[model samples]
Target: MKSIKSAGVIGAGVIGSGWIARLILNGIDVCVFDPSKDAPKSVEKVINNAERAYKNLLRSPLPKKGVLSFLDTVSEVAKSSEIIIEAVPERLSAKQSVYKEIELNASNELIITSSTSGILPSDLQSEMKNPERLTVAHPFNPVYLLPLVEVVGGSKTSQKVIDETCSIFSNIGMFPLYIKKEIPAFIADRLLESVWREALWLVNDDIATTEEIDDAIRYGFGLRWAQMGLFETYRLAGGEAGMRHFISQFGPCLEWPWTHLMDVPEFTEELVDKVSNQSDDQSGKHSIDELMQKRDDNLVDFLKVLKENRWGAGNTLKEFDDSLGNSRIDFSELDVSKPLKTFSTHIPKDWADYNGHMTEARYLDCFSEATTELMAIIGADEEYIANIGSYFTVETHIRHLDEVLIGEGIYSKTQVIYGENKKLHLFHWLHHNDGRLLATAEHMLIHVDLKTRGASMPGDSVIEKMERIYSAHKNLPKPEGLSRAVGDKV
Candidate 1:
């Protein structure tokens, strides 16, 4: 899978933000555009989500970091991007209009994928100038964490487009399922719509409350669906007779009136109110955001279990770990110091070693985590690093000055020694829960080009931010570690 040098996202809605998170987490450089007044808010929400994803990935292993940027127009992003993901609203005319503008600005080689639901690729391509270049790549919500993406091609879509789309999805750690023929709602959504119709009918007839229906699925079928999909479930249902026998018995339901697809629900005031009241009762007192968070939490827990077993999409974790390997960095002594800012991280039980002290590796991990926070304070937060491709970790020299037992938190004081060009030198002093200096680690970081894997100059904006901090510390006493530089200070 080739790395996406630059990608463009054409919307900033929830799904758009989700696409942004997925691209950014996978080490791609993405530029996003949306015409709404709340575009910035949308980007911020995605960044927060990306941060949460980053934390989760680190809980297991470090994930590839991607750069993210926002543009004012579709044409602006299209002009420079290698790939374009159209996530504008689901309206055909809106998507077609955006496509026309993108075609005018983008290169012929740029692959364009849409996140449209139930929109046939053939119909969507009919509206485009170069129809062969576009395909529909629909992804589920919370796209950064989830692995499934349905890749569907149109009549005019070239084989090359399909192959390239598959490659791009894989690069971003997604499971791309290609549909050989176009079908409305594709595969998964069609099945979901069938079930949804039945659910509405059940509520309309008051046979079961909305929550009961949901419970039936979540506590029953949903559990099975998580590991084995529909066909496999039905195979088991056949009791060793297999799908043919299972179909023979269930096929008679085709003539039943139990399903309500033929008639649209009246959606009358009474029906709407009934469904609404039942939904509210089913959800209890949880707010919409609360429900979303709950769903995310559950998915995270489930994915972690899969990750531990290396099952299903969780196998992607092994790929992620393979990419991480046994990388380590060490930087022993450096120059002088500024007043140290106190930073603390609680030592989790997992960090405890067989000897009952914090594991040496975890000491390094916590110190690295501290470095991330320091980078954030120095203006190297998610968005900035996303754009500039410059991160601070170079080398660290960690000394186990004292033992840290379980249930204890360690604090660190970071003092900047000096910084020049694209490098920063900092000193760290680790302390125990009661505030005694435990160890010290010196860090020498050279800003890097994430795409090229080489040292590069820090962005001017980032350097300016760093200079301001340096100026503020000019009058403060130099840190103890910098005692040698006291007489020869710059």
Candidate 2:
């Protein structure tokens, strides 16, 4: 499938705004339109969300950011976008009217998709000028981070559209579940709705408070679900007997009165209040942003571990590996005169010293982080390291150039000092927001066997990577701070 160059998001509600953030952060140019006067504000909120998501993504490898535009009309966005996503409301008429406008102005080649929650694509496609191009691309909330998207195509939708949409979602780091036949609520949500019904019954009958019910799941099954889905977990539970055993043992519960599957609990104001209070109590003191950050932090760390094992959802590493196959280390060619990627980071409270300047240990840590980022660029990520059971980083020397205060913006730059088989020496400088070089660190790294924890010959693939960059920058002068070398010659 061809890469999506640009996308358009229609509507600025939570879902649409999330789509905007996700698209832009994935480096796809996005144009958004919503008639509401608050549309620009909504776009800004999305951009802000993207920025936060971008930071979270940095904990792993992610695509670069894309250009984002806020358009005044739906037609304007459609005119410029290769893929147009309609996130207008769940109302049938409102969505149909928006599709009408889209059909009038959109290019025939553009893919038009809806983010409708329950509305079937077949129903929406009935009025479309080109029903084959219309499909449902249902996504979870805060779409920038979550990795699941359900792609439901209508009766008239073409195979080409379905395949293309699947590829697009996969490229953007989301798992796409293609629905061969359009169904209400799609797959996951339908399963979730069943649980939701049971949950409501439990709460309505006072068998469990909302908080207690959530705890029962969050503290128990949620952990398993995070790593593997229900089927896999149940398969494990069955042990050597496998899924059939587990199912046979529990399948009889389906007929039990414990679940009021057909009952729809009344959405009364009192119930809402009770649920709200329970949710608030469950959340404790976390603000929305705080909760978002917590989720991001966990996802980042989780993905890092997945990347290590190359397990499920570790597809991000595979994507990274593919990119690194063509990965060019251009740092030597780039003027190390300036920071290549600059982002403000306040000195963490833990990094402070007795003199109130940043601690010596942290100075080394900051430069170490910069070097790790450089290694990431050159393909030293977890999977690569795990596969070979080898990693780089032999020695380091840090010199404090100037004092750094806690909570001040700290910047960093990596300069290539030397490169060879299984080894690359680098000099990294930590700078204050005021442009002062607070400290500099020089490091010598050797590829070592992770299993034995001993120095080893660099792998051929790693050596080739190093040779290419070293040959290119052969004549360049050594970086500062490397003039003073440490260690006894081996």
Candidate 3:
């Protein structure tokens, strides 16, 4: 499949704007078409919000953001795009008209997709000149952060279209789930609809409030479902017997009429009031904007934990991080005799504690990032650690010299104090942008073979590079606190 460098988005509502943000953040220029007068501002707002969340969510360096153009017509977007995603309302006539306009202007090779949550791809492609080029690429909300995108093809759609769409989505850090058979609502939404239906019934019957229902999920299976889907989770619940035992135990529930799956509760005023009042009582203190920020913060924290475990969505995030390419420093141009300026960043608001200064733990985090950058300089990057060997910090001594307020700029200068085949000793001085020394960390790292999980010597190239750095700094005067014990200075 041809690489996509540019994309087009129709309708600047929530989903469409999110797609625009995701594409732009991944370095794909976006051309957007929406009839709404506030389209440009709306899209910009979503992009800004997405950018904020990504700074906390992503640790790897990102490509330069892509350019965004607000166009007057769909034909203009179609003419310029390799892939066009139509995210207008779900009405058939409205979407068909969009396809007509795009088909009239776009090339036959241009891949066209619809963001309809449940509409059939076949129906959406009916009026198109080249229906085979169209498919359904449905994505979840907050599209910039969530990775799931359902790729479904119509009856007339070619396999090439599905494969290429999946490829493009994957390239942009999405986990594209291909639905073999084109079905309404695809997979996730159908499952979600069932739960939604049950929740409504529970509220309608006064058995549970909306808040209670949400709590039931969020505090329980919601956690499990994030990492493991229903079947696997149930399989474990079945104990040693696996899926068969699970099916036997839970199969009878299907016919028990325990859930109102076949019917939706009436949307009467009373029902609406009950649901709304309950929801408000549960979380009405926060405004929509505040809630959104909280949601993003919580997601980042949860994803970070999953990242450490390398499970589920975390694996997808890790893959995306690896694809971002290394940010290794080119040491050949630097004066290795002086401390290498390896890391620099501004403190974020979330890093502050009740005292308004950066939290104590964040000091170690800053030092750790500096150490990682130093490793990158010595030829130990993500790929190197994955394929060859890697250095693991076995010990660290940190002396806090000062406090840093939120939004203050800071940097770390590192020196290689000692080096050997399997051992590396380093020191990092953390300083505010104004040259005030804030902290210092001395780290001892040991090379280890990831496969064997045992100590191992690094490659000859790495050893040579370390030696060069160590030689350059050997004659330099050591800092005062270099080997001081943790207790009193005496």
How would the candidate models be sorted by lDDT, starting from the highest? 3, 1, 2
lDDT of each: 0.75, 0.75, 0.88
Candidate 3: residue pairs that collide = none
User: Which residues of candidate 1, in runs, are more than 4 Å off?
Assistant: 57-64, 248-257, 324-490
Candidate 3, 1-490: lDDT as tens digits: 2358999999989999999999999899999999889988989888988888876676565677999999999999999999999999989999999999998999999999999999999898887789999999999988988899999999899999889999898888889999989788999999999999999899999899888899999999999998898988999999999999988998888888688899999999999999999999999999987987788778877777788899888888888776674544466876787988877766766788988798889999988998888888888877798899899999999999899886577888998888878989998999998999999999999999999999999988888888998998877889768976698473
Superposed Cα deviation of residue 94, candidate 1 (Å): 0.8
In candidate 2 the C-alpha lDDT for residue 154 amounts to 93
Model 3 ranges with Cα > 4 A deviation: 1-3, 268-283, 325-353, 381-458, 463-490
lDDT of 1 by residue, 17-99 (tens): 88887777666788988888887786777666555544444343334566777788899999969989999888888888888
Per-model TM-score, in order, reads 0.67, 0.78, 0.81
- Ranking of candidates on TM-score, top first: 3, 2, 1
lDDT of 2 by residue, 293-364 (tens): 677657656765666677766665446434423334464464433333422355644457777677778777
* C-alpha RMSD (angstroms) for model 2: 5.5
